[model samples]
Target: MLPREKYIQISLEINLFYQRIMKEHMLLIETHLPSVETALITEADSLKISMEQILSETVILANGNISEESIESHSIVTPFTLPCEEITSKLTGATINTNITMAELKLEAGTPSCTPWLEMEIDDINRRTLNLLDVIISYKKKLMEWVLNCKVFLMIYPEMLEHLIREARLYKRILNCLLDRKLPEFTLCEELDFWNNIMGEHAEFIDGMLDPTEKDLKEKARGFIARFERLVEECIKTAEKLIIQESLVATEDLRDYEIDATIGLLECKIRSVIPPILADHVLREAYHYILILNHK
Candidate 1:
């Protein structure tokens, strides 16, 4: 009974509704990552649609320019071959494929238009945004790697040490912040889950070393060191994964604590065990990294 235009509009609306649903559905279940699924079912439910869906797969061709929605699809990713005009004066020999890409994009050739157009430049804010993102996720992975190592340490060690616990808690927070989309340095939890599984391993190693027998104390110490190395490797691997996967963060992030006294205590202990120079280097690097992130 409605007018023709009304019927058409209704049909279009129905199609759009389906499109939105499909986009959401594709986003949630398609990735096949349980973490992503959990996020989709929880915090990201509202996002329903990913940035990719919102952006669409369509490449923007404006003012003889071409760009893809994803960085991986950019021409820079996969380059083709094109011929040069300098070498070949004849149009037959001249080709258009590779060289014309960035320098001279091939649009539907037409006379230059005088109509005004908006000009945007790639600048600092964009660069900083990307770099900050890289750093946050990078450090976040570092934190997780430590967590995994600590986890292994937990399974093997007899007890936890205060320092290991403290670092574990700090690292957990840094990861939570990354998820929450908070700047790399924020705090959400009341108590730090300080001390990692490695602390327990360290305690076990030291306890064994103090024992009169159980002669494998030196071997045990080496095992503890090897575990530490594994933990660091896990952290690095985690950072790389998060960056690649572009993992989401939780709502509340973590902040740094006033750990000057604790750090000093830790430094003293570390100096006693390791060379003064190595201890100093570790302390300085940690201090500088903290200051840099905190200032931002």
Candidate 2:
């Protein structure tokens, strides 16, 4: 691969890591949002307008795409603590209004919150879901910009660079829908298996790169390359399987994502990077040793 391509591959791998973290954040948000929404949907039966208002505000925070300023001005997230059962028992049934300003509440020994509490609910789930879709779509623009101009593509190793670039292409296409809530079970299972296999192969790649060349270490390098190729072949097969099963598996799981289908993805990229870096390390040592010997 050319220098430019190699550099780009590295950048792609880095960006892929970024994408993986974003997925983790999404998973965390989803973990709580659904149940919170379910509870609100059940309890907020009589206050439709109030509930809807709260839902809209929560959805904005839940999506987590807007600026803090935008959210703050709109009070996208409420901050308040409800009275414990002990305190509530003293007051019978007191209703809290949404209009209460958060700053005014005195948070002392007993009071827990400054403003009224808001709950996320299902009536506005569609909005949040659609917002997620938009975020994923927006990611494409970022991916394109990185793919086209990332510094990693500037590396000298053209062959390796090209390989990484091609893989990034596959990765980018798959990224489109990886965040969808309604994921396919079987396909996710298959992708995870494939991702694990790739990780194993990548580990070997790292070992091969870091290893000092013995009397026959070049032979080992060749063997390692063969194994790497086999792993790639397996990955290709897995990719094909996804395509055959569903026309858009890539849209759901990037070649680099660490979802159920793409877990261990970062480790593999790290592994892939190690080999060349190791080789360079050894090469530098060889050049220094040769100079010393010649001087002697």
Candidate 3:
């Protein structure tokens, strides 16, 4: 039987094996995630349109002698308030028809104006205003969600992927070396439980993206990526420990070669795998659906 260090070394090798699986998983997820910056920009543009609609409603309400009571009760958003004032000022002096002018005067004088034309216009404003307000409120909630999603995307993907890519190259080096030696003594246990666990996690991430019941892919993926990142960190630590411990048995110059070779292997692996993974249909579908939802 091999010495305990050799067994521990095998266990470490097994750990590195699973680390590569996780990197691939992360790559798949990164590939599938929607362009968050684009999504946020789209939402911001929609919110801007909603704000404009609210302002337009305000103008109609003011011009048509909408009651002070209605404006006070419904004008919860600040942007609508100043525009109401501006519309009143513009209508007070502008030469429209006599009826509309009287309605404007009556509105400024704080009396209810009841001309049917004015009343219908005011009614339309009320309906549209209420609807626009609801949209603005919903947009505010979405803004909060977007803030969180953007933070996760910014913090996680660049650093986490880079680490995983680096660690994976290192593992490939060790794998290649072990393979070259034709060492049959080192066997990953039959189950390859660690690899299975990572694949399970990958499946769950994909399921979240695909499940019709899931409301927001970015939100779900954000959580999964954060959790997966923690797991990757632990796996990288284990891999690095193995590399350091193993290097203690080698000459200084040889140790440097091992480290460089491992890094080079991971870089090569990432180049070969990532672009094709990103092009996969599952990832493309996720991006498509997310864009559709954002536009809606």
Top of the candidates by lDDT: 3
Off by over 4 Å in 1: 1-32, 35-37, 40-58, 61-63, 66-118, 121-296
Which ranges in model 3 have alpha carbons more than 4 Å from their true place? 1-36, 64-110, 146-296
Model 2 weakest 10-residue run by lDDT = 107-116
Clashes of each: 22, 20, 1
TM-score of 3: 0.24
Residue-level lDDT of model 1, residues 37-76, one tens digit each, is 3442332233323322322211121222222221222111
lDDT of 3 by residue, 104-175 (tens): 233331333444554444334434433543454454344445446665343233333343343344334443
The superposed Cα distance between candidate 1 and the true structure at residue 43, in angstroms, equals 6.8
Q: 116-166, model 2: which lDDT tens digit per residue?
A: 121112223333433443444343333334445752222123332233333
Residue 178 lDDT (model 1) = 30
lDDT value for model 2: 0.30
**TM-score of model 2 (CA atoms):** 0.24
Compared with the true structure, the alpha-carbon lDDT of candidate 1 equals: 0.28
